[model samples]
Target chain A: MLKILRKEIKAFLKDRRAVMLTFLMPTILITVFALAFGSGGGDDVHKIALLVCDQDKSEITKSTINDIDSVKMIEVIPCAYDTAIDLIKKGKRTSVLIFRKGFSDSVKNLHPLPLDFKYDAARVQETGILQSILPKALFSGTVGKLITKEYFGEKLNMLDSATRYKVFAALAFGGALSDNNGKDISPEKIMRVNSTSIIAAQVGNIGLVQAVAGTAVMMLLFSLTGMGGGLLDEKEQGTLKRLLYSPVHPSQILLGKMAASIIVAIFQLSIMFIFASLVFHLHIADKILPLTILIFATAVACSGFGVFLATLARSRSQLQGMSTLIILSMSVIGGSMVPIFLMPQWMQNVSVVSINYWSIQGFYDILWRQLPIGPLFLTKVGILLAIGITLTLIAFRFFRKNVMALE
Target chain B: MIEVKNIQKSYGEIKAVKGISFSIHTGECYGLLGPNGAGKSTTINMLSTLFPPDTGEITINGLNVKTSIEEIKKILGVVPQEIALYSNFTAWENMMFWGGLHSINKTDLTKKAEELLQLVGLSDRKDEKIKGYSGGMKRRINLACALLHTPKILLLDEPTVGVDPQSRNMIFELIEQLNKDGLTIIYTTHYMEEAERLCDRIGIIDSGVILAQGTLDELKRHSEIKDVIVVECSQTPDEAYLISKLNLNVKVTDHTVYIESNDSKKDLTRCVIGCSEAGYEIHHIDIQKANLENVFLKLTGKQLRD
Candidate 1:
């Protein structure tokens, strides 16, 4: 058994093109995912150009523009109404906010303001963000202007001494009320409350990790299919018969080939994981034990499927056709090419039968969902091991029945 | 030693081997000679323990081929008709791999591989990939791989087909040397000359049945066809008149006349006189003594290659 394994490994390593392809394919996949998912860091703040067409040149409108510009997420650009409309039509600006003439009086009288908003329909996400933020900005500016006018004189601006005194008085009143209520309020309490409310979300490049794991599993299967061609090649070359002429049993030959493919798959997945961690800063090493077990089980299952494919095919061309049809379909349906959530519900339910589905889900559990090492993780591992063992037995039975009978 | 008794195999409705039986002594080169599709490979396959015979028994060294295949495989080397080495591996690597399969230790396998490579005159090219080697070189390595374990019995099925003359002679010499060293060999080929030169006994098979089996001289003596006479005439001869005048079995094709005769000298003289009396001029006359080809023709009424 060891001799056969050693020979198989030597033959695999000698094929330079195959070795290079195993690593090159995953690298390309990681790069494409990084580019598609916006660097995978999850911290990318989208900047949309917002054109403000202030028809009412009141102090309230100016204050509204300042408030909108204070948000780092949206860039505010002041333009004429006609120019803003032209820019929106030309698709240069995603959204335009218009302030009407009676906007300041409406706020002072506590009436609804006539605000007109125009957005480019093509930029749906940007338009949505702008629409959500515009209402809050307008209301805050209107209410602040009303408060300033009521507390201070109409001639006093927002930054005047009287307005500042009012703000100080309000803060002092709030503090005294808190003390009278027997509840001590301080800066530290506020800071502590703010910090406690901020949850520690799942860290690391989730998109990059998913991409690496998905592509790694899919490519691992592809590589196994290619490696499985060795079986047919040996039969054609008569080497399989020669091997049988030795003291080794036929099962040992099949085991040797499967062992080689499993090793290759494991090696491929490890390289992809390491590359993702080093280049994209993914947190693959956080749960190293579970991750390693998942990778091993995935490799075993895929390698078994590869052997099954090889035994089912009668020729090299047949193996090629079957592998293309099966691997691609599984990859597509199992969320390697597209996310499972994007797939139809029926298709997602059907994807449970695919090996890629279990592998990708297992990886997501560890790297993205950050599920603790528990039954969820063990369940994935169990399914993969079951798949590997079951498929391998089928392959062995078929091989013994069909291939071993060849003269 | 190997023994086969009434081995028969069939594929669905087609019978491939029909109750064939043979045996090889401890140190004899036995040849199974036949045309294509003659079940020679099937018989070799059965003896090699590749597959069990449908309704017969085979044993090697007193071990049943069906129940004792593992023990049988340890003592048999099969060099198939096809070149079976991994093309991507060097010749040395191929030898090592095949040798390792028999559980040969690394040091001994390496040493034996070197010795075999030297014997096949491929020692200088052992490190070259099999794909880069010529057809003859590949054939030589194929033979070398089978001999790695030094099995007691070697089953070679058309091992020299498509090989160049140099390699063919080299293979013949190698087989002869191995046989001289007490290796029992079962060589199958359609080439009569190879069988005549190498085999201690030849089994003439056709259409999945053994027509005859014996030494070359014994087969010749047993056959009625002692010699074949061919006469080239200047003009087409009348077939009816020639047969009437000579009162002998004669077949005329175009301007040539063919006759299978037990007495070459007497028949040639009679043919010359008979043709002269019939006003036919003889351009040339040739005579061939009885050999394996003629013996096969006499027994089966078909050429060995047919």
Candidate 2:
């Protein structure tokens, strides 16, 4: 076994081109993916410039402008209606909000306050943010003004009939002074606390991590398949027969080849991850141990898969075809090429059978979800190991029967 | 010593080796001489334990090949027909790897590998990758790799195929030297001259069966056409006249007349005298002994190279 291992290692080392290509390929792939996916930093806030055309010029319109400006992500710019339209047309501002005339009087008279918005539909993120926050800002601005009016202790008889009617109408709709219970409601007691159950974890550059891990796994399979061709090469060169003639069992030869592939895979993965960490700042250092274990398990599983392909193929060309078909299919369906979440639920479920699925999911746990190294990590590692051991056993059985039998 | 008894092997419906048997003594070089597809490699493969025989048994140095393959492997060295090398690796590395497989100690393996490389005239080029070496150099390394463990028996299957004459001669010299050093060898080749020059005993097989097996002289005696004499005539001779005059197996082609006889010397003189008296000028007379080629043709009714 050691002899075979030494020979395999020596052969690979001597082939400088193969070694260079093995390491260089993943670097190129990661670079391409990072450039394509655009570093999913998730840190940059979308800035939407809102041009407000206050035709009403009423206190209500001013308060609404302030409410919109209060949100840190949206910047409010007051301008004339024509200027706002011209700015939106020139792409200077992402959106424009127009408060029609009688906006305050309409609210006071229990009539609908007309507000119009013109936005850049091309800017999806900015448009989405504006669409969600604009309505809430408007509603909150109206309610805040009505509460201010009630705090002044002004009676309805002191104001005009239309004004009085609008104030009561605004209060009725705002739920601050609803008469359903026939009790006066205090705005201070109506607490507006914003809370979220989702805690933000320090997952650095998710897009870059996914790109690194996905490309690493895919290239691991590609490189291991190429390594598996060594078996066919030996058979063709008659070195396999020579090894069999030695004082060793056939299983030793299989084991030695598999070990060599696994070692090369681990080396390939290490170089890629180190490159990713240095260049892209992938946050693997926080969970290094589990990450290492997952990488090792993935390497083993991929190596075993390579052996199975080699043993199953009768010729190098056959191996080439089969490996390309299987590896590319697995990469496509296993969230290496496209995220599993983006795929249909059925396709995502089907991807569970792919080794890359488990490998990439394990990496996601460590690098993205920041899940602790617990049952989830163990399950992924165990499944990968089981796949490796089982496939390796099947490969050995085929080798013993087909290759070692001198077929 | 190696012994094989009625070893038969078949692939699908084709019988590759049909119950053939042979043995090699402790220090003798035995050759399996036949045409292509005559089961020469199959027989060698069986002896090397590359595959198990369908029937019968093979024992090397008193170890049964079926039950004691590991023990048999310890005493046997196989040089396949192909180069069977990792071309990317240096010659020294290849030798070291094969030696390591036999569990040779590292120190001794290095020494042995170096010595064998020197013997094969590759010591200076040992550090170079085999892919850069010439065909002859590759052949030399192939032989060196087999001899690293210093096995008692060496099985070379057509080692000289596709090699240049210079390398072929070098291989011949190497095999002779190893045999002189008291190593048993089993050589398989389709080249009759290689068998004739090297093997102490030759076995001629065809279509998975051995037609004959014996020493050079013994095989000649088995041939019905014992000797072949060629007479080159200055003038074209009539086939019928030459046949009638010599009263022996005579054939005329172009300007030469061939005669086959049990006694070559006597027949040569008679043919020369008869051709001279008959006014046919005999420019040259050549006498040749019956070789493996003729023996193969006579026994199998086909040329050895066919």
Candidate 3:
């Protein structure tokens, strides 16, 4: 038994790929997770730039902006309303806070504050973060004391005795009367936040959109690479040599693998979207044509990436280890695992090179931005197709010089 | 016809094929007989255009391998030593895939796949996945895959390795039939019997060189070792006694004595009389003719299997 154990151990140790993967996978995963988590909520690491158009320019709006900036996670950038709008439209900015033109008279006289919050619909996570923080920044501390005095001291005193008692009872009861227990206490009315999604105005649920697109993009890459590993499997089985023996160019074989992977990826993406639509009520019918094109381009890029990685590795196990490490790293940095806004600036910059980033971005344009098939949308698709073509060309060269040599 | 002229291949410092040349007439089954690592597969790989030789040239049907590899591929089918197949795919599916690679149309591919599977005697089990196939079954499918294109030339590299006797015979019969149908063949095997049974002419190769090439009779005629006469005695005798009595080249192992003779009939009479006069009871006498094994032994100084 000990002899067998020693032999098995020696065999396992001899397989350098397996040994490297055994230790490397966990180490890399832990490092990636650490980087994402460390930068995810840290104030210094991931600072969300909040574009502010101080149209009011009042003492109160200025103070409100100052309060928002005081929060460690937000960086306040003051720009003109039109500039902020342009930035948001171009996807350079996630959210923009606008203090609409109003005299300081409203806050002094205890009237409703005029404010408008506009954000990119695709950056739904950023929207939620701003929503939670903006209210606290607006209503907390000195601002909250003044608003509470006017909101309750003036309005409640004006109510009739019986109505006031009923209102107080409902507020104290805290069940089924949370909304009706008070007058004009809803978040929208309190902040006068006419929140508008400058892009994809019709998109209802951005969470489900991101979930579908992000998971689909990441999963598509995983499956495509797995399929690409078939190339190495063929080499091992000697079928690749047989194929080379036939009257087919080497590029044709690589292209055939890419084409198969693309077909499978498209089917996988379509099925996932269909399931998302059925189960999660994701709206797909209106944008089906653009979505299909985006899916096709994404598939092409991912399949190319898969084939390229296949050519890089000498065997199937090596491909598996290398692809898993690469795809997971790409997923994390590319905003599939973590929202791009939550990642460090450097990681976001690095993500532009990953296939997952382009794929997810293309899906976002179709589903979240709802941008028509215009220059912006086509550019994303074009980049994906270009990446696919470039990787495929490189893979072809490698296949000819290395794989066909059969050394 | 195929002409290999002074072809040499090297993998870094290891010279696999060192400036070897041979010619094959159309429809001739030429065997490359060698032990493992004797460059047989390397030569076949070069012939199949899997890789190019480091120097010299190969021309098939008057077309140079360097410029006409694509054209050559259309006419060449290679059955490698390893069973080159997709185990997850059925035998039928594997044939269709290879057929597709050969640019065969779907209609013809279907017809050819059916025909080849039938020829391989696996038509009934064509739908079963190859992962579950026995070694012999996979070997049959491996051969069948190569024939899907109906090429003019076939290269069989140790195709019968690890196969049972029944399947080996089946493969031999299939190869014979294909050759008879005017398909030129290049067969590489370490098994002398396989080469003797299949090859019209044989090339004995070892250590990256062709030691000799000829017909079986011619190879035997050229061997250094002559006919062997064996005299098995009832009791063991010392070598000195046999050598002193016979005064011939005799080797004694246990109770048997082997005598090399130019004339076996004359030597056998002298050996029997010598053994009897030396008080050694001759139990049996047999004469063995020069065979390919002996020829290989005389040339390489090692057994064929070694």
lDDT of 3 by residue, A1-407 (tens): 99999999999999888888889788888788767657643445466789999888777777777888888778899999899988887677888888777725555665556666889977877777777666556555344445556556666556554444333333222222233435554322333556777886445666677678889899988888888888888888788888888888887889889999999999999999999999988888999999999999999999999998888888787788899899898888787876776766666677788877877777777777877888778888999999999999999887776566665
Q: Estimate, for each residue in A178-234, the C-alpha lDDT of model 1 and write its tens digit.
A: 222222222122111000101122444445655887799889888998887788888
Model 1 residue A35 lDDT? 38
What lDDT does candidate 2 reach at residue B284?
88
Count clashes in each candidate, considering only residues at least 3 apart in sequence or on different chains: 0, 1, 0
User: Measured by TM-score, how close is model 1 to the native structure?
Assistant: 0.68
Off by over 4 Å in 2: A1-200, A405-407, B233-257, B265-281
Q: Sort every candidate by TM-score, greatest first.
A: 3, 2, 1
The pairs that clash in candidate 2 are A108-A166
Clash pairs (backbone) in predicted model 1: none
How much is the lDDT of residue A146 in candidate 3? 55
lDDT tens per residue, model 2, B116-169: 888888889999999999988899889889998899999999999888888889
Selected candidate, larger lDDT, 1 vs 3:
3
True lDDT of residue A28, candidate 3? 87
User: What would the per-residue lDDT of candidate 3 be over residues B26-130, giving only the tens digit for each residue?
Assistant: 999999999998999899989988788889999998988888898999999899888898889998888888888878899999998999888989999999999
Score candidate 2 by TM-score against the native.
0.72
RMSD of each: 15.1, 14.6, 5.2
Please compute the TM-score of chain B alone for each predicted structure, in the order given. 0.82, 0.89, 0.85
Q: Write the per-residue lDDT of candidate 1 for residues B119-145, one digit (tens) a residue.
A: 999999999999999999899999999
Q: Candidate 1 overall Cα lDDT vs. reference?
A: 0.78
Please state the error at residue B34 of candidate 1 in Å: 1.4
Candidate 1 Cα deviation (angstroms), residue B102: 1.0
